[model samples]
Each structure stands twice: as structure tokens, then as C-alpha cells.
Target chain A: MGEHETPADEPPTDEARAEAPVQHGCPVTDSRGQTVLHPTREQYVDVVKALADEGYGMCVDLVGVDYLLHPNRPVADGVTPERFEVVVNLLDIYNRRRIRLRVQVPEHDAVLPTLFDVHPGTEAMEREVFDMFGLSFDAHPDLTRILMPEDWDGHPLRKDYEVGAIPVQFKGAPS
Target chain B: MTVSDPLVRPGYVATGEGGQEMRPRSEVTSAELLREVGAVLRLSEADAAALADSDPDVVGEIDPDLDDQTMIINMGPQHPSTHGVLRLMLELQGETVLRCKPIIGYLHTGMEKTGETLTYMQGGTNVTRMDYASPLNNELVFSMATEKLLGIDGDIPERAQWMRMLLSEMNRMSSHLLFMATNGMDLGAVSMMIYGWREREEVLRFFQKVTGLRMNHNFVRPGGLAADLPPGWRDDVLRILEMLPPRLEEYDTLMTGQPIWRERLQGVGVITPAEALALGATGPILRSTGVEWDLRRGEPYLHYEDVEFDIVVGSYGDAFDRYAIRLAEIRESMRIVHQILDKMPSGDYRIQDKKITPPPRARIDESMEALIHHFKIFTEGFKVPEGEVYVAIESPRGEIGCYLASDGSAVPYRMHIRAPSFVNVQCLPHMMRGGLVADAVAVISSIDPVLGEVDR
Candidate 1:
């Protein structure tokens, strides 16, 4: 749905209709309170749009998380489902403030919508996430290994990723 | 004539176990050192250094000698330009650096990804090790982001804020002192290396006194400090305040007035304001280019709005300007430090919010809930109500920012750092593009990159 159209039948929030994204819901309190969690995919989109309207035009970085051993979402419950989360770090040089969008997605077939259409900086950070955590950004411009070589298997940074297993070498580390 | 003829006729000495030469050795220029090294390594004869104009590591388009064309010179992984194990491929003709490509990640530690597994409080411990030199700045910025996310930024105590400001300026001074020391070494001022490091050691002593650790002091938490300043922190800091200025003046006289230092720095590694901005430069590099945009001034967090200090700027934006601006900043930082010490207010140092800061250690033994709270906080860590926030502070190098994502859990959802050295590094090639290859060292020194920040 276009920004203004709002799904044709649903009424938009009061501030959305006002167009003053900067004054975003004075002391911006949602029914969700201070900590907006689990963001139910649609809530994620609304938050991003509202923030964009608030002047954070740049999504500076994005990284994924694996809650393989989270105490709250303990793995004793058989493979922590929906334990994966993505953090989108946004910056607005114009406004001089920043925000972090924590969007959660499940571990199995973990994927999230790519905001590459809006920010270019996400390109590098997302590819890095894909390389390390195997989480996919649906439409990232160019998803490929950045720091690691093409033949290298397993992201070195992942919690489950093995280290010292791959005796590393560089431009020319001879056997 | 044979190249060994010069070696035979004069007091030309070879390096050895001849009792490791005393440093601040009024040795030859690094170029001359490299030429001698090339001879020692048997890679080239002594005359080959004089005959050759470009780095031997490159060939064809990579070498200027191949076509009388632009040559690519690899400046690091060993060269002095990169402060640590960083490499830059420079395209050069004669002494002019044409196209410089900085190849980093030689020291990548995976700190950000490592941070994901750590709890919110432990996260500061992990991130603080990145810059190594300015540990408080890293922790302070990261803690601020968590505070904003948890909606408790204002709950931090007044004394904690002032202490953070105090230690932060001290960190800035020592960090800039290191820069001065190293920049002088890069410029062939032998004594400056000694002078700068000597001053830095004293600052480290102060850091150890207050935070209990020399480099990685996870002392600045979101709501307050890691621990209150140690007893006598006041007296020790006062001593440092007394010691630094005269030494700085000593450096000013020893090398700042020397024609060789001026010649090496004045017109070298010139970064214009437009290019610095285009590349997202920060700290000394950006200020040298005349931006006058410091987060301390622009946003003014931690009662900075109340403090009176000047944002030092330089006119030329070259290696000299980068040096002079930082030197001036150190003096200004000292001024701020003195003010923080004199004006500090007495109160509880940590935040009162029970959810963030645990009850007193004494109370932990008496109250079961307090004991459990302290244990849980120290062991598993606290939750941050699923949300995200970014907090940036002006580090010695530039803008050191932390973007934190919390999922109302024990550990962070994701943490990404916007390191100043990483951004400031982009302008290296631009600054070096039209400069002589010889001046490349001057430019690199001016940027004062710490690969710990870059590779992290």
C-alpha cells in the first residue's frame, strides 16, 4: 500500500495524517509502552515509516542475532524458535539523532525484508550478516561474502561458527 | 663505482647485537632506512634504492618504473603510515601518491559479532577492548545507547556524569599525546617519540588509578559508572594536570619549531573540508579541515553544554594541521579536566534505578532479593525492554558510535559500531592522491589511524 493510501479501508494514525513526522506523537507513547518488542511484522513496517518521516533517512548498518542459548528463550524448549533478531541501525544527519530497529524473525528459514531501496549503507552490513549468520535479506542489492574469501565455509563470527578450525592465511600465506 | 665503496670509506655501521641501539636514535630517514633494509634483505643493492623510484612489491601498472606511469605502492602491514598492521596500496609516480587503496581487516577481531553473545552489561566489557587506547569513550558511548533504549538516560547520577566527562577528557589528552608522539616519530623527530610516550605513560597511570584498569576500563555504564572513582583520584588527576603542560611545551620547542618538522608536515596530506565531509571524516581529521563540528559541541551530552571549552580548528587541513589541532585539543582537554575536578559535585555515583544498577555490595549480604539481584546482574545481566537506540560520542579519533538492539532479553539482539578510524580512513587515498610518495607517511601519520578500531 502506498504511504497515504493506507490499505484503502484502514484509517491511518493521527500523526500520519498530519504529515509532521518530526513531532512524532509527543513523548511518543504507544500502547506498547517504552520498549516495543516482537514488533509483529506490520508493526515493524509502521515503525520504520514513522521513523523515516521523523527524518532518519539513512539506515547505517544492519546485523542479525542468534539466540541459540538465550536464558529467557531457553533452548530446553527444543530449538529456540523465533529467536533470531535483526538490528537496523539508522542515522539522520539532518536531524542529528539515531534509532535502532530490532525486528525479530524465526530461526528456521530466517529472512527479513531488505530496506536496500532506501539506504545504500545497509548493502555492506547485510552481506556481512548473511555471510556470518545465514540470515537472508529478501532484496539486498548484492549479497556476497565481504571479509571472507569465496571458498571459505562458515562465517567466523557466528556463535556456532568454528574457529582455529580454518587455519587462516591471506594475500599470500603459503603452505 | 661499487655501492660498497661508500660503506668501506666511512663509519658506516651495520645493525647487530651490538647492544640494541639506544632509541630516539638520530637515525637516518625512513626512506634511507628502507633502502638499507632492502640491501640487508638482499632484495636490492644499496644503489638500487637510489635507482628505483617505486615500491618493488608492485609490477606492470602497479609499478611506476614499468611504464613511466602511475605505480601502486603498498604502504603498510609494515610501513609506518598505518599506525598498526594496516596496508595501503598507493599508485604513485616519483614521490606523488596517485591512487591509494587502504587494504585493512588485517586485525579484525569480530568484536561486534562477539558482542551479540554477551549480555548488555558485559557488552561494554567486550566493546571497550576495540580502541584499546580510549576504553572509557567506547564504554561510555555504548552505555549511553543502552540507557536511551531502557529509558533511563536521565537517572544517572550527577557525579557519575562529571567523572565520565573528566576521565573522557583525560582519555582524549593521553590519546592525543600518543598521536603527537607517533606523528613526530613518523616525521623523523627522534626525541618526540620518547617525549610523547613518556607523557602517555603518566596518563595511563591515572586511568589505572580511577578505573582500576589501564586500557579496558568497563567503568562507564549506562546509568552510572563501573565503580565510583578510587580514593585519591582527585590528588592523582591534579598531579597529571600539573605535569603535562610543560612537557607539551617541551615538545613544542623540540620539534614544532624545527624546520624539518614543518617541511615534512606543512603542505603534506592535505584534506579539504569538502573531501573530509564526502568521506565522512571525524575528530582531528575533520576539525583540521575546519568543520568545527564536534558531538561534544553539536549535541552536548553529559553536561557538556555547561562546560566552557573551545573546539580547536586548523586552517591548512594537512598533516601539520592534524598535528597542531590535536596538540591544541590536548591543552583544551586539560583545561576541561581541571574544571571537572574543581567543579565536581558530591552525590551517589551510580544510578538509583534498581533494574539497571544493583543494590550496594553491603546490602547484598543482608537482603535475599538484593543478593539475587546482584548475582543475576553480575552473572546473567539485565533485560533492556526490546528496542533500539544509537548513541555517539566524539572520541579522540572521531565519532565513535554504538547502535544497540535489545529484545527484552539477557543478551543484545545486535550491536553495530560506527568506528571513527574506519570512516576517517577513507579520506587517506584522497589526501594522498596528489602528494609525493615521500609525503605519504606524513599524511598517514596525520590521520593517526588505530587498526584496532579500523579492523574491529
Candidate 2:
């Protein structure tokens, strides 16, 4: 089956309707016919939960991107772009449909509620975002570093962070 | 007689408060060592009392509920069975594991951060190193994502698509062969190691002939392949396909029907479907749960829909089920490869679009505009339009996805590798919980996580 399957038969939840300002309850198409949802940070978990109930049970991937340098990033009409964006890809296995959710978290207050309670598989992914982008997840069980050392000084993935270089050493070549 | 014995000299030895021997230093290389030892020995009564009274902070806070009798053991940042530098801290109650925590980052190279500095053309080189075992999958996902962002996906030539599927299936075979070798070694079937590598060497020789490297082949690129397949590539693939079936049957005789192998793997490391979904396990781990979700068949990218093969599934999610699925998948991959060889298309290996790929070498020498286009494409890479895309493929490990965001620049704004091994490793704790410590190696090998991807 192709990705252009009919939407789930379940009625839209009230929480999903409330997210109309950020994203219409109807799914929007991207290049590949993936339904892209731009939910506000407040409605992030609610939208994910609502979709999970509708058989988009598998969380394919959760990714965090720093749009620090990309100020002109496109967004829905009513929503403002943020410094950091968390992108989630969910799949409905039985239906063979893919959905993409993009949520914006501002620079000053870069916090989004945890999706771990809904998708327990997101535990490590959430920790990775906290490690790389310094974005916190509220009510996350353990928000420690996953990819970097625990004592690592700064978020390495931020646009402002320098990509520092360590000089290569050769024996008896130089001090 | 004991006190006066010449062998037990008085000043040569000291006894601890608990009557343990404190041997005197015999060969002091430097005065500094001698002085430190003398100072330690000559501590005055007050100084010694002060030393005894001091309490060290090294014994930090422990979980209050952790029983004092619980034995915490570290498996590896350097153990043979971990496949890499993966370290697992296990809290054990006798022989049974109570809790397991995987502490990674020992192999972290920060490839994602480094990807931002490289241009879009150079992105494949960085991602191919993430999942080194199945490098083409990484390259394919990154290239597809880049193509999607550039809106040039439709322009890719047909020959290149078939070539990609062919090479990827070969890569899948090689990766699974490595798994078979390592899994056997981990499970104490030492002879299977030799047999597995013998078969894998045949496959790698073909890879070396095609890509000029055994592993980390950055051959798959944004628009298409690095170059067209070498002469007689089809015959080479057909020969391998003809030889693999009997070798796979040899494995059946060697391990599949063996009662000991079944006893070690069956009913061990059971991950329920609910737990598997909750933990986001994919690839064989999810397939073993009877999900029937193979991205190649389900998502249908890279002309996989044109091929005919079954999505191998297992009745029970256990180590044996995972093993059976992988073995079955090798057969399925062989079937796909056979079809690809027959239906191989004859056309340009890469897209003819000047914006995405440079003009041919023959055209470059003949025409000035072609030369200039080549120079521009190589020196200043083509800029991708402002957008984001997440493209995934059924890698040997799992759904290896690449999330790329471009900002109308030659270099990507952000690149995130949704590494399958990274997510799959999280389920290790759940699998190992309450299982015997001896079975941990079996479970870890069954997951077959490549540390390059896990700690990327």
C-alpha cells in the first residue's frame, strides 16, 4: 500500500481540535505524501497520544534540529519559528501511513513535555536531545547525557558551539 | 622461635591493624619515592590518628532502595562479547540480574556535529562511518534525504536504482554473515566462526572489486552512484547467488538442527510485542515479534516494490526467532538479488541533471561549458533548497533514517542520524532483566548492535 491511505476512522479528539491554531486537525501533505503536523509544544504530547490511539503506534524516529542559523525557516501561518525544533516520525504499521510532527521550542525556554509516558521507546532519544541541544524534557525519568560524556561542558550540536579541532600527533615529529 | 626467626626481620616488615603484611619497598628508583614511603612510615601518633579519623567522599550516595547485598558488576568498555566498547552495569541478585544499565559514549566521535561542517556532497562520507557494517544503507538514506530536499528524487536514473538494490542486498548478506560468525563465537561454537568468515570473504571480494573497499564504501551518492558497475558485475553476483544457498544449508546442519544451539537460544531474551513496540525495537527484533514490518516491503523505497520477496516474520520474539529471521532474510535477499540481475536496466548510472550531478568526464574535456560545470559542482557544491526531510531504509540493523534540514546553503543546517542500533540497544536492559548472567552474551550478540552506530 502507498502512503496516501485514508485518515484513521477515529474522530478527532478535543485536544487535537484545540491544536487547530498551530495545525489544522486535517493532515497536511509533504513531498512524499507524508502527513506533516506542526503542533505547538503544548500540544505535542497530546497530538502524539491521539495519533497513537489511532494505530500510529510505532514511533519510527524522534529527531532534534537546531534552526539557530536558519531564521527564515518556514512555519504554519499562525505559529512562530523557534531556535530548536523537535521532529518526530510515527508510522501506522497496519495502514502503512507515515506521519511527521514538528514542534517548536523557543531559545529562552527550550522545554517540551516528555513523550516517554506515551511512547516509552523515546526515553533514550529524549536524553540524546538534552545532551546534544541542551533542550530539556519536562518529567523525563532520567535526562542525563547519552552520547556525550556526563561531564561534557556544552551542547556540541548548538550552532554557536565551535567545531574545535585536535591536532594530529606523530612520534618524533614535533612537540 | 617465630619472633626470633631470621626470615622475619623486625624493621623489614610491618603489620596492619588487621595483621596483614605491609612489605617494605626494596628498589626505590628515585629519592621522591623513598621520601614518600618514609613520610608514610614516619607518621606521628597525631597524624596517624587524624588519617584514621578522616572519611573519604569517594563512596558517594547510593540508591536508598538498593540492598547492600546487591552485587554491581561492569561487563565491558572492554569485553570480547560486547562487539564494541559497550559497557553494561548489572545489579545482580546472586546469578540473576535485577537491573541492567547500558553506559555508552566510549566510541562517540560526534559525527552528527561534524556533518554540519561538511557540504552536502561530502555528507555521505560522514554518515557511512556511523553504521560501518552496512555503510551503503547510511549512504542511501542520506542521499535520498538530500535528493528529497533538493526535489530531484524523480530525476534519478533507473539503472542506478537497480544497481543500488543489488549492492544493498549484497551488503545485507555480508553484514548477516558477520553476525553469524560473531554470534557463533559468542555462543562457543568456535568452528562456525571459520565457516562464516569463509563465506563472507567471498562476498567481500566482490565488494572490493566493485567499491574498492571491504567496508565503509561511500559509493552511493546524492544523485546516484559514485560510478557505473564494473564489467561482468552481473556474472559475479549470479555466481555468488548460485553458491550461497548450499552454504546457508550448511548452517542448517551446523546450528539450526543442533539441540544445544536451540537450547541456548530458544525461549531466551524474550521481548513481547507490546514491550518491543514500547521500546522501539525494529529490524529483526521487531520482526521476530511477528510485526511483519520490513521497510523495504512496507515503505517501498528504491524500487523494492518491483521485487518479489516475503517479509520474514517469527512466531515468538526470542533470540532463536531473531536468528531464524536473519537466516531467512539472507535467503530473501538472495531471491531479490536474482531478480535484480535479470531485470538490470541499461542507462546512465547517475542522473543527467547538471544541478545535481556534474557532466560526464568525456563531455568535460570536449566542451568548455561542461568543464566549467564540473569545476563549479566540485569546488562549490550545489545548494539545496530550504526544507527538511526524513528518509529511512531497511538497513541490516533496523530502520536507518536520516533527518536533514537545509537552509539554501551548500552545507546542511542540521543532520541527525536516526541510527537503528542506537535505539535498539536501549532494549538490552529489558531483555537482560531477570535472565542469568551467562545468557547476557547470547542476548547481546542476538541484538547485533554495531558500536559505531550505537555511540555515533
Candidate 3:
């Protein structure tokens, strides 16, 4: 009888059902009360476009983070956080709500589809991520070095990159 | 006195021992001279190739059809009109700009990478240097983000909130005033520069009185300010408020109606609302495009919701609209400052949580525990729970957000600044694409990008 009981027959509880973890293309709120969506690298563009359709028009910021050292960074259960993550912040101007999309990219193939087609503002930002973290954006029009020199030796912002400094010389100091 | 001596003038020759040969220097083209110099310097083809590869002036591919007529010109990493060390590559066809690409990183100090090394407590010092024009705004955004990451957003004192509002508003005024000065100079209104700087100096004097620095006031810290406002702070604020309104009117008289000012800005560098939104433009730039989206009004942080001020909007999204929006925003900021002075709270300037902030100097002298707590707070700095948060404030240039990710350590795992100038400068090409080359200066000045923030 318990198993066959209609769902409406059950008494309503005071507590709302905790939102189920979104495994596919739905948005979930993070612990910090931010609406974070974990979209697969394949669904990145579609998810972003869906959110954009829901009035999240502006792509406020786009940045890449190298979690090489901080592999233990928390994510919802059953979701595997990858070595490189591209975080995109979207703003719903009319509603004044913010949505962050975190897409995990594998180390071997650190390539993600470009959001430039959906959000033209991501052109420079995508270039910046490519320049800093050695991540690549497929179908990006001008995927060239932005901040670093064109022939710069390596991606300087990666966690594993060496921190090198050149000693400053004074006018009268020995060479 | 040899007859065929190459040293002799070309027209005359020395035939005998007694005769003098005079040779005019061969008409050397500049290109020939350069070739000879290159040959003398032993510049090989490999060296030439290397130079071309490393040359900062190397322009990207231009349209093949117009390449013959379009000449690429470099405008700064040094020019005064650029406002900072911003370099622009302008492909010009006769006086019209075919395309303009803003090349940054001349002033890049890698502040985001540097932020990873500093503790949460020391984060303000690094961020404040990024947007040096609006230093306090950087401090405010960084502090707020750090506080949010620490989950102590509600723990900030009421007095600190109002103080933050007051000082940040004043910083906005100072930053706008600087734009006014530079904009005027860039557009050839040199006298406006003098007037603008004079007014800005007064504001800086007030900043010095409160924060102990004319620029880079890293006084705003996580959990609250470095210290409470000094005595007579209200009186000083009142004087500034009183002094500014009439000066604003004087600017109206000087430039608002001036034909040259109007001509240079009114219809130049027009950006549509769709373009502004798609480009993620915020602050005055977006507002100038008739979008009433201000973080203060839209997503109120601190006590901005409690304050009474109108979100200034512009009708036409042009250079003039941007200028008008900034001018009106200064007045609105003053109004907010006045409101703050009236409703200023009397309480702890910073949170009293000893774990986050150091103990008062007076308390340290009385209690050994206080001294130890102070030492630990400064040297070790309190750790934040592992999480990430992005907090943005309506900075003078635009939305300055700090995206901070914590790994349960005193130092942030990753700190990415969504610097408004960095994002806003991307729109320059959009604005300057088809405009006359002369209007490029007007457009760049109107955008008012701070290169420090852009490059960082």
C-alpha cells in the first residue's frame, strides 16, 4: 500500500525538496549562493545559449583557472572536476541575477568550443585564456597571443610555470 | 690630386698634380643610405627576419583590397593622447580609419598572478595598484569579494558600509575629474585641463585627510577599513560637496555648450545598445547606451539600496552620451555623499571579530591575548573556507569584479580581476572601425580606459 500510494496522498512537508544535482544541462546553486551550472564541454555552447535565452544576455567575464595544485577543489557529488576549468559569468540585467558556468576541460586536449558566436564579447577574453593557460578555443576567429608577445616562450599564468625575475640594474652598477 | 679620385666632386676632376678635383656627394636616396648602413653594420637576412618577428609594430593582416591604400600607423605605447602606455595600430586610408586594433601589455605587471602570492589581507594593496585612478574602488571590490569568500558579508559594521560608500563616491568623482582633464586635453581644450586638475586636487586633499594617501589608498580592507574616519570628517566632506556643485555648473558654461566640445563628441564613436550589451560593456559606457543597469541600483551591495540617488542614463550611445553620463554621475555621487554625511552611523568602523582584523592598539597594550591575536592576524591572516565567489562593484570605468577562489588557505588559490578597463577597451575597435582617424582620439578619450587596469 505504501509503494502504491499516490504522490498527492502524501502529506506536505515544511521543508522544500533539496534541489537535485544537475547532471545534464540545468543550473544549480553553489554553496556560496551563486547560480552555478556545470555543463559538459560538449554542452557548453548550448547551455550558455539556453541561459542567454532566459535573459542572461551579458557575458560579464570569461576566465580560465588551472586547478593543477588544487585538485581537491569541491564540486557536487558524482561530478568530476577536471585539471583546467573555464568559468563564464553571465548576467541577467533585467532580473539582476548572475549565473556562472564552469566547464571542465581535460589536460591532454585543453580545447573548448568558442562562445564568440553566442557572445561576441568573448573574442578577446577567449584569446586571453588561450594566451595564459595554453587552452585553445575552436572556431575562434583570431586565436593569437593577446597580452604576451606572439613568440612568447610559454604560458606565464599556468600554475606550473616558473616564476622568473630579472634583477634590476642601476646606472652606476657593475654589468 | 688623382683625376679619377672618387673623393673629388662629381662635376670636376683632378687631372694633374697641381689641379684639385671637387666631387659633390652622390645623390643618395635615404633607402640607399639605410642599405649602406645596414651593410656596414653586417645585418644579415637572419637578423632581419628575427627583427621582423620580434617587432612590436608588426600589424595583423589587413584587407587585401585596401592594403595598397591603407597605411598602418602606430599610436603610442608612448603618446600623451593615449592617456597611458596604450598602443593602437590604426589602418588608415587617407584620414579615415579602416580598422583599429588596441595592442596592450606594455604596462602589464601580471597583478593577477601576483595576487596569488599575497594573503587575503594583503590583496587590497595589489588590486588598488591595478586601477590606480579609482584606487579605493579596487580596494572596495577586492575587499568585498574576500569578505564574501569568507562568508562574513553580513558581519560588516554599518559605519564601515557608509564609510565605504562615502570614500568610494569621492574616488569616483576624482576619477571622473581626471577623465575630464584628460578628455579636454586630448580634444584641444587645454584650459579645461587646468580647471579639471584644480578641482581634482581638492578631492585628493580630502582623500589624503581620510585615507593618508593622495593615490593608491589601500585603506579599505576586508571586514572593513584600516581605521575610523578622523575628527571633522563631516565638515571636510560638507566643504567639498558645497565647492563642487557650482564648479560643475562652471564646466557646463566652459564645455557643455561650447561648439568645439559638442562637435568633437556628439555623434562620434556611436555604439548601439545591442553592441554595448553583446560586448559586455558596463558602468558609464552601458549607461550611455540607454541601459539602466547599474550594479548599485540593479544589484545593490553595501548600503546602496538605503541611499537615494538616480541612475544616470543617456539617450544616444555616442561619445557625448558617455561624457554626459559621467558628468551627471558625478553630481549623483555628490548627492549620495551628502546623504551619507547626514545618515552616517556611529559604531565600529571595522568588524570587531579579532580573528579577521587585528585588535585595537589600546587593547593590545592592556591584554597579552590581544597582542598575540594581533600578531597572528597580521602575520598569518585568517583562512577562508574553500569556495569561490565573484563580487563586482560599479567602478568609475565599469564593473570591476574580483573572482576569488579559495583552497582553505590564507592566500587565494586563484584571483582573477574582471577589470572594466580590460573589457571596455575591447570595444574600441568596434567604435573606431569606420570613423575618421581624427575622431579616434575623441573616441578613445571618451572610453576613458585606465591602462593599468587593462593590462593587469
Off by over 4 Å in 1: A1-146, A149-151, A156-175, B1-68, B364-371
The better-scoring model by TM-score among 2 and 3 is 3
- Tens-place lDDT per residue, model 3, A1-175, is 2222223122212221143445234435465777576778877888777667767899999999999999978875556889999999999898778878888898999999998778878877998899899999997756777777555667878999867674333233575
Give the Å shift of residue A112 in candidate 2. 1.1
lDDT, model 2, position B69: 56
Reference-based lDDT, residue B186, model 3: 93
Give native contacts recovered, as a fraction, per prediction.
Answer: 0.08, 0.55, 0.59
Interface root-mean-square deviation of model 1 in angstroms is: 12.8
Tens digit of lDDT per residue, candidate 1, span A56-115? 654544657665555254111122236676766555555565555556577666777766
Top DockQ: which candidate number? 3
TM-score of chain A of 1: 0.64
Whose TM-score is greatest here?
3
DockQ of each: 0.09, 0.26, 0.27
| Cα misplacement distance, residue B222 of candidate 2 (Å) | 1.2
Per residue, candidate 2 scores C-alpha lDDT tens digits across A70-95 of 87788766668888999999988888
- Indicate the residue-level lDDT of B381 in model 3: 84
State the lDDT of candidate 1 residue by residue for B1-456, as single tens digits. 576553332222231111111111123233433332221222335445543654433322122243335444456677664688877766566777545556656687778777878888788889898888788899989988888878888778889899889989999988999998888888788678898999999999988887777898888886888788878888888899899888888988887788877888897888677556544577888789887878898778998988889998988888888888889999999889888988899998888887778889899878999999998898988888775566788999988888665667878866778778776776676677667877878888888888887767
TM-score, A chain, model 3: 0.82
Two-chain complex of model 2, DockQ on C-alpha atoms against the true structure: 0.26
